[model samples]
Target: MSAVSRLWRRAPLWRLCVYGTVFFAGLAAFYPAAYLIRAIPSLGKLHPGALHGGTAPDASKPGPGPGGNGGPPGPGDGRISFLPLTQGLTRAVPFGGHVLPLPAGVWHPVLSAQTGPNGAMLTDVYVRTDRGVVSGMVVAMGTAQPIPDPNLLSVDSPCHDDRAYARGELPSGENVVSCWAIGATPVHDAPGTLNPVVAQAVDRLNALGYPIPPLFMTMRWMHLTTVPKKGVGLEQADVMLSPAAPGTIRLPVPIDQWDRGAIAGAPAAAHFVDRMRVWAQEWAPILERGHAGTLDPTTIPDSLTMDPAAPAVH
Candidate 1:
């Protein structure tokens, strides 16, 4: 027992409480700020091809790995390499007796279930960009609802009942199902118009020289899914494209004013279909191949195309 023991005994409880409170308060403030910075566009640097994930490396010229970045993985390399808004990275996940090719910045994993019994599993990813929000899902030999009929497509959102459905087959024979609908609500009625987080983000964006337009637009949703032979499984991607509603408050233009044919023929609607077709063509062959690794299935040892121990695909 020395001077240190005496000092410890004299330390006031109030002082300790103040220090603890400050530390916890700092932590509480830090996390939400970090999340918003990532979630909000303009808050972070926009990677190239924000709409389609970052632009893919030039196929004409040789580059490094899947993404064009050459050097070894540094500290910045995340565990999954699929972080939200991260561009120029691609991964192939094995599923449903096939592989799901995750497009570069376009598909960022939001949630994934651990491989369940008998190779049952599910994965969900999203791409939020200035034009729209795209959601991609993969169900590996698991039960999921079938694609909705055209009339029922809008049931999931505040969209009108009238929807347009389109179907086609990829070059590789995979089935493609698509539907589009217009949202029904107005922007002012949508939630989060007055949210403090949203307001602060808008202010920061404008301060950074990115001016936001009036929060109104025609909200359009397109849901597309690729079906494997016999409907064994599916890879689904849907996009909700808003013309004017850039921020969180997504309200729709009045349906009465917009002709039904006009909505289907809009430029945004065409763009959504174009993107979906590109994704379907790129992914169909990969799904039938049933391989996720860089090396060919024939070259790999144990003849295992996917994970050996986990049997990720059926």
Candidate 2:
């Protein structure tokens, strides 16, 4: 009835047998070859620690000698060796007229937008981790606006609206405000106006092969007054660590307010909150130095033989 049936009927018995064998073999080989082609590209972007089934070593921890665990690769390694997390981060990059510690690993630049007075700039860098969690930081320089104190927000507010907000003062007296939100305002949602910066940033990230989840939980820390004596305006940094979720959590009753402790205790948010806490403290001083114009990129050792020496934020 069909051409294949006609060929099968006319061919001699051995010819049919050989043709059938070749056809089945090629079919089997095609799938594996296709799978390999799809998988090979991701291998280059994988976290090195992922290969070993553990988290990458802390960036602050020094590696053995040259090109060791926490250090950048030496000359002999013919390929670009993957460093765990933010290790091998040896230089500060300029952003919005201030220098900031650049995140390593899969973290890449998303958007650097200037929508503030006098060309004040806001830069956001983000990455989708191997586990599908999204983590990143936003730095703003010479900005007139200050992060609102969460304590003053009304209880009816979705998040950062409770007295449970936490605050700490750095050794140099800069204020650090941290908060967590279970159901944050979605960056892009239907029936609402879309922010141009966020829209463009998402497009760029998608172009770079990173996918943004439809819904996510957010943990944020806002560092205030990093440039204590800036003549023009305030300099601030906001860091966010968010994990993707399949859908927004449903509540039995309307949420009147959110308590940080309660949110941190929730099973869905506990892990991300803990990681955010550790990262917030670790990044505070480095961000401070960068905003204060005290971190010099030139002093960072190429070999990463030792940590760079920068004055405490004043």
Candidate 3:
């Protein structure tokens, strides 16, 4: 007989099935109720009126990184000179920890937030807003789980996922889409040829047992769009950067045949789209940080949002 069966036989048989039912029912009640609780609106709760986490910077600071300008400083007069998005955030809450294109408006300060590591070696920063709690992740191709929509334009990112569980949805019906940010392309997932020599070198590396580098090294944020369904999707969409040189900013790859400058006015657009070339050189250290696993999300900028002088992204 199985070890579990033997132990059961030796133990008391009182209410065996009843005990099992009670144990399972308790868990059943707990899980579904938790998910359902999210749908309800709570009044008078503290809101995260500001942007939190390293993935997103304070709108006022206009510096760089996930939290500031990803390029050189702006003019001395305080304009910051970076892309608008990188300059500051529009501000808001968490609808499942996702970041959307900052809409035009004033964003309030964040009352509080919580951050932590997530599946696939990614970092998750949860921000509370007037609407609700939203999640923002610093994604890495090695561990990100993205949801892909067939209705949207597709790219060559290797780490994109089509599963429903991969997406973060809001009660208002908006969905977040993700990809290689604005300045990157997947090395192997590109549909057509990437120069002949580079392709050959990538093949050789795989043969020697090294995986092609993932796009997450440089790009990560999700694209915000209004979806028809209560659910939407995320894809590791890409743009062409790196014109065979280091730190050389190139124009974005057009999603359709059109004039080139659609994204020219976007905040930090140039730096974001071109970040991959610089990141590829720093890949080794990036990998080390991901594996180290000591990220703290609690410090994701609640203090920054509280300052009225702080530049707000909204």
Candidate 3 C-alpha lDDT tens digits along 1-314: 99777767777564487588899875443332212222431211222221211221211221112211121111111100011111223433222333222222333221111111211111112111222211111211111232233323332222243311112211222243322222333344443323221233234334544333322122333333434553222322111122221211122333221112443454343343333323322322222222233323232235322221112321
Off by over 4 Å in 2: 1-91, 122-166, 171-185, 188-196, 206-209, 215-232, 244-265, 296-314
Candidate 2, 226: how far from true, in Å?
A: 11
Estimate TM-scores for all models: 0.31, 0.43, 0.21
Best by TM-score: 2
Query: Which portions of model 3 show Cα errors greater than 4 Å?
Result: 1-260, 265-290, 294-312
Arrange candidates, best TM-score first.
Answer: 2, 1, 3
Pairs that collide in candidate 1 are 53-105, 53-106
CA lDDT scores, all candidates in order = 0.30, 0.36, 0.26
Worst 10 residues of 2 by lDDT: 305-314
Per-residue CA lDDT of model 1 for 91-187, tens digit only, reads: 5544433444443223333322212122122223333233332212222222133322232222222222333222233233334332222222222
Model 3: how far is 175 from its true place, Å?
36
User: Best-fitting candidate, measured by lDDT?
Assistant: 2
Model 2 pairs in collision: none
Q: Could you tell me which 10 consecutive residues in candidate 3 have the lowest summed lDDT?
A: 74-83
